[model samples]
Target: MTAACLMSTYQPLALSFNKGLGTRLWDQDGREYLDAVAGVAVTNVGHSHPKIVAAISEQAGLLLHTSNLYSIDWQRQLAQKLTRLAGMDRAFFNNSGAEANETALKIARLHGWKKGIEQPLVVVMENAFHGRTLGTLSASDGPAVRLGFNKLPGDFVKVPFGDLNALEHVRKAHGSRIVAVLMEPIQGESGVQLAPSGYLKAVRDLCKRWGWLLMLDEIQTGIGRTGQWFAFQHEGIVPDVMTLAKGLGNGIPIGACLARGKAADLFTPGSHGSTFGGNPLACRVACTVLEIIEEQHLRENAREQGERLLTRLRMELADDPNVLAIRGQGLMIGIELKQPIRDLTMIAAREHGLLINVTRGQTIRLLPPLTIDEREVEMIVRGITRILKTA
Candidate 1:
């Protein structure tokens, strides 16, 4: 932190972790902390997982990068796994969630051209977080993120997340010009908000009726973070386009944009590309991450542990006057406070030896590893209760 050479885009926590296991981390002071944040949901199978470590070690000895001009076998395997899980026809790998979304938005524009619309507008929900890039930022719901960046990418229309009537209104007014609808299955940045029940199905029907593509952002909720492989699976309907990252590579930094049917054939060889994308190392590691998630049954663990955590939190904090709301699904969880307790992050670390995060100022976000055990769930419940009670 004292190094003046690095730019200060992030205000990192005071303590640095030296080692990690399943749900535990040891800091520089040798203080053990329960990592409920789980590296912000990147380590789905857990830190230093034996399989993940071995995969990394083996692939590093092999080929790391050979450029996209040639074919990558691991990349094809990773895409095959993702497409099977996502129920999409094809996938394109990128380095991060932002790039995944950027790919999705670009595909939307191309689909618009096929629909005979020159300036196609994609409808996005409010209070959603896509990414930091300008194209994704323009589609994002946060005004603060897009504040300094002027001239955002054009043809993006905003709509209330859970409002079906407002979407209908937009369709009524600008029916021909709108080419796609982009949304998160669950709004992660806006305090773990769930779209109203039947909202996604309704939107799917609407898109089918009007010939507009349905693009779902599953970067945070994909890869078994939710009980299902992807959050959209809960609704039992497949989307025209879907983007994934985060847990996909278990911290190796890989993302994929998937498409089905007509959307699948939209991109040609020269139309879109990435140099470091779909490299052997990242893809092999991602394939191992997926295998471990299934082998360990972390998806079921996410369901049971997440349910227990939420229920216990509600039971513990229900009587507390400061708690406003508690809502979540699977491992993606949140509890909103009546007041802004921004400093609670430090307090949780200092007092309870727990790593957690606060989003939207007042909402405490819990994105623990999907492999959390019953005992660790109890620990998280207690740690969060202490923070909420004292704050």
Candidate 2:
């Protein structure tokens, strides 16, 4: 009942939730709060959705897990569904976004090795967050996450986000040594920083010109969080490699690394694998989550509600001098303040009865469920605007 035995990995809030449904959560004492975080963009379909719960329950009752040594029907089905949606040819399942990204990194390395590059390099974007693992951390550009992790693998080249010239320079400098480019379509942890218009298409063209795999870390922006099934779709482009997790299983631990063209064929039998990656339970649940998103038309809901929330928040906070910028795509919104307020999360929770997240020191990040309704969108806009105004 206490945190005595847990690791000191997180300085958690002083609250615990006992129940959640849709965009609302109830603390142990039954205090209701609106959930704008969505488990940091994991629960896209919302908390304890009936369909998700039923899928989990049913899958658990049927089968939980079997190692990858054997064939998993649900896993194959999930792979088919995900790859079809992502416009990729193949998928490799994993346990989390970090592992999925690790898979992509390995693919990049192998793709380079096959082309006779001794030490392959992956170009990563500044202020991008891939994951916490060593490989993913190396691909990421966050100082705090990389600090103290001494002597990380140095095969990654860092470039500024949304800067095409920086990428061109990397190409000119690194050239053939660069095997792939890994980046989030929208930088989530550093705040919801989107690339410049047409930046992704330009990057894709650059990758084609340089023979580098275009890898997109869609862990945060995928699975309908950005209105589209994948954020890259917004630009009418498909990445050579895409990593997915978070909302894929609707809270179940599962990740996927999808690839196409030469990148798809790089991973062979012994190249990479995971024991519990695409177990029956996880894959079935993921399939169910995708189904629910489509059946309920949550993608359209996210688009409409996201526009409503963004417009309302902009209108409400536009006059505030402290509000630096208000920007978002679909449900992934961020409100950047002029100064860092580290306790914004605590304040939002305790004072306004809202669950939110503060990222990159000053940006208030919102990843409400894709199923959020118009009324809930208004509530979020009001709650967040009040916090910004009164803070």
Candidate 3:
């Protein structure tokens, strides 16, 4: 717990959970709390689901890692399953969201390289948070995340998320020099900023016109988290490349960048890889996660519960002067306050036994597990109502 023992990288709460199941978590003292955060959307199927636990345990005993030199059966099965779900032709596995994004960015660069472009730029949105690596951080936008990481890698151009005019301007100016458009369907780290309706389709059309690959960062929105296999599916557009992680492995550290069309064949043998990603253990757990999501109908569950939650919150907080707006799709919800509520998460957890996060200064971000039910949604609404009353 002291700085001498471990690096001070995270500002985590003092409370530690010893066990968790579904939407409930028990701290070290056996204090049960309604977990609305769900490890920031990592445990979409909820913590310690029996199927995932069994798969991890079985795979651990059978095999863990065999390097990228040999063929992996579980990895292949997972790639097939993910590509089918994602509507992408091929998948490249990596260790985290950052790595997945890194892979996709590289593919975009290579795509431009095939045409003999010297430096290709990818159009990213302002306030977008792709990842924390040097490559992803370059694609990402946010003052706080980029404060100390100066002179970061840059082949990325920025436009306001959902701003069609700005995007059009970028396309007009950059033209073929822009190789791709990489952005999140719903911006997660800078708060849950959903792209406007029909916005994605517009981007898809523009990408087609400019001959740029459209890469969607689905790290926080994929794996049935946003009530769909992929959030972009809601707009009826398939991205050329899609990066996935977080809920894909349900707390296991694994990620993938799926590609279609010419982008799919960009990476040949020895082009890209990860030492521990998509190993036997992680792939087995991911396959099990997919099976559980489908068998349990978690996607439909998320849509239903999310609508109920959003409706109830809007109704309950309608007249509150401090409430700015309530917005989201499926389980990815956000409550924007009129003033900064940075400490709201701490207060909710400490006093109300509910976990939440504050992002973009005043927005209360809630990403509960997709497996949550109507009853649990009711608890979440009640908890928020009680907490905001104090605010």
Candidate 4:
């Protein structure tokens, strides 16, 4: 009930919510707030969705978990669905995005080792975020992620994101040592930075020519958040390895590492495993989440609402001097300010009764639930516009 018991990792806002519905949250005092952050994009179908709640309640009553030693029917069904949607051949389950990315890194190392290459290196992008674990942290960029943790694995080669020439330089310099190139399709944590047009396709082609596995960390851009089953589909390209989490279970906490071609078969029986991964409850909930997204046509809604939000924000803030850029895809939108506004998130919550987030200091990142309607989108645009104009 108090912050004293928890670790000092996160400095959460002073407010706390007692309940949540589709795109809305209520505090202990019964004050309502529009949730644009969506639990940092984990609640794509919206908070406490009926179907998701039903699935969770039913699965809890039936079975919660069984370790990876046994065969899980739900896991098999979920895996089949996800791989089919992703165009990947196989999947390995984990508990979080960090674990999923760690699995991909391991697969890349194994792929290199099989070909008799020693000290395999994975090419990563600068300002890209994978996860907080040591291996994933090494693969990620930015000093905040790498600070305090000394002696990180030095096998990752960091290059500027969206720069093909830099990638080429890495290939030329570390061609033999490099086993894979890992990056986010859209850099989410350091603000919603999208890949340059045609960049993903070019990276896929380069990987094909250089014989390096192309790994995409789609933790934030996957599921129905990007108006597609996965962000890679937007570019019409497929990577050898892909990592997913955040929205897969719609807040149930499940992560997956999907692979195709040679990358699929690299993980042998004992090579990698998780105790709680792919359990019945998580898998069943994920299956329901996927079904809800498909049945309700949430992806289409995401695109439409996203475009509506983007256009309205641009129109409203077009003449504002403080606003620099407005960019987004689907429900993942960002409004970059000319300078960081201190305590912007707190002001949005306390004064405007809206939930939001700021990343890379200057970008107001919005990851509203995919289930939001027109009225909610309008509310978001209005709240954001007011905050920016006053700031």
Candidate 5:
């Protein structure tokens, strides 16, 4: 009906949308779409969740921002909850995934400097997506995202993701200079690539052996997206430092860097801080998001629905030779194709009343809300299967 007016940096389809509920999004034309993107994995509790809306409305009327100088009760409460859930001792909140990751990089640098290492290196994995900030950009290995930015920070040791042998080999060679091993439980922006079985445990043990901090970037996979509060929980392993954003605040601009043990003590008062981090309103909303996730049993819903969705895709698309692989956990899933299918994103949206994303060129990533139900799961699988078959 009308041309898009948004900036060029983002490529929103010509469909104008309005409201969303549960797993469905409605456009201005009253067309409904089964949403599997979940605002890039931010709205884990689902759009317009009653509790989250109430928290935002209530907190907005109360105190919003007062800097970090005074004691913000809500911020402290959220920090406590996140740290407890993460099995970490301390937390520093920011406003986005990049900020959270920026804090983690700072910690690694500080840890390295403390030990008299001039050039403290961080071990990162290929296809990792940390964030867009300068330091986090250096940490990310995605070619398209990293393109045109020359002379990126040189301290990152790039290793193939899920390659435990490569990790061990690099650890032995770079142990003394390495400060941290930063990775994502699942490579989100690179197409929901999950590490191999027992891979996280092996990495954790390797980090311990080398006395390097294990920092997990759970921005897209956290907040029950992976059938647990955090993806690493599936492996029953813990990281020394972790970065969180995306669904943490249910769309309220909040990120956090959680640390445990010695890593927890690395950040002093002036060593790191954020102006809008842990603000009253954002923290209050994040707390409510966590509450609703637990109260509504979204984790269980994600596991059950995700299993059904994954099974249906494999079974339905099994005979289709174009579909290469189906891999991922919980709501974070990816369907790889034999060839690049980036164009299929728009095709799915326009033709099938669905919204899905193509990442790493050839893989379709599904990040449905944790609150998605069985019916919606079936719709998503059916819609995508149709698109793949026709394409």
Candidate 6:
């Protein structure tokens, strides 16, 4: 197959995997892997989850696409469930995380336009990854990701992650022009960088005081992966707008921008839309995925199993100075090393039958399935211990 035909552009892992279930992946060569990365955090319910697969299969047999012009019962039902889970008034469905974020950005712009602000600005954090769309690319922090894209969207004021003082400084300088503050609860791209304790509460307080919208990009941290339905729950803060995708349908390509309070009323009829946003098939799968997560107590499973994995890793590799940090919440863990270990990602996979991922050159990211068993966790730890000790 040609690279042009495939959407995966020069990706390192040329995976020829044929089958997967739960936490295991088997390639064409008949080798099994303990999948830890979970397809970059999209396969939260796990690959080929029976309920999700059945729902998709059944829905496909019935109706595939009925553009958003008609009423979709499944879409409405899924929206209600998502609203209840995220404590939002409404949701606008899209195709992927970038589209969800694009919708959120439009909501912010509309809010600013309503306020009579000529040049609206949204405050974004350092090391935050929104998505790869033009608008989201402009908002993202990596220069390499934005390289060669001429005239990227302007008016965003960048601030350091977890720094309330920098946020306050920006607010002081551009309070009138700013419409929203957009960020990820945990900076997944920058080595899973977490905010300081009480940072989110402070952000909420500031947003309320300054009359700015607080938007969270939960594309990677939402669903049951973070031991909660959303990571913001851990901080006890509710955003005016929250963007979700990645794990919503367990790889079904659904994104949502949930709006609350004033922001909810910004997007009026005919203002913004998508053709296949809330089609019956995707919505049905999403609804089923949410149900399975709840019914199986995967959130608690993520919490319990994540703690066990992290604890064992810390205890086992405590003596290695190269292991600088092991930090994460629930199943979203990052093992930061003293130096760049990009090759370790390949080594772990090829030699030990483990599938993992590295980010920011030095941090190994783990987005294991929420259904990972204790034995699987031990297997992962054992593999890492061997690789780290020898490498």
Candidate 2 vs candidate 4: which has greater lDDT? 4
Cα lDDT, model 3, residue 258: 94
lDDT winner: 4
Candidate 4 achieves a global lDDT of 0.92
In candidate 6, position 52 carries an lDDT of 85
lDDT agreement of model 5 with the native: 0.89
lDDT of 1 by residue, 1-391 (tens): 5358878677777788989998889998899999989888898888899988999998899889998999899999999998998889999999999999999998999998887898899999989899998888988877667888888877888899999899889989897999999999999899999888889999999999988999999999999998989988899999999998899998898989999999999998799999888899999999998898888888898999999999999999989998999999999998988888767899999999999988888899999999889999999999998887777
Runs with alpha carbons beyond 4 Å of true place in candidate 1:
none
Off by over 4 Å in 6: 1-8
Candidate 5's C-alpha runs over 4 A off are: 1-7
Per-residue CA lDDT of model 3 for 212-299, tens digit only, reads 9999999999989889999988988899999999998999999999999999999888888889988998899999999999999999
lDDT of each: 0.91, 0.91, 0.90, 0.92, 0.89, 0.91
Residues 1-391 of candidate 6 have per-residue lDDT tens digits of: 4477677555666667999998889999999999999998888888898888889888999998989888899999999999999889999999999999999999999999999998999999888889888899888988778778868878788999999999889978986999999999999998988899999989999999988999999999999888999999998878999999989978888999999998999988899999989889889999998999999999999999999999999999999879999999999999999987657887998999999988888888999999998999999999999999989
Could you give me the TM-score of model 4 versus the true structure? 0.98
TM-score of each: 0.98, 0.98, 0.98, 0.98, 0.96, 0.97
RMSD of 6: 1.4
Residues 109-136 of candidate 4 have per-residue lDDT tens digits of 9999998999899999999899999898
Predicted candidate 4: what Cα RMSD to the true structure? Answer: 1.1
Global Cα lDDT for candidate 3:
0.90
Evaluated at residue 35, the lDDT of candidate 2 is 94
Candidate 1: residue 132 Cα off by (Å): 0.7
Candidate 3 regions exceeding 4 Å error are 1-3
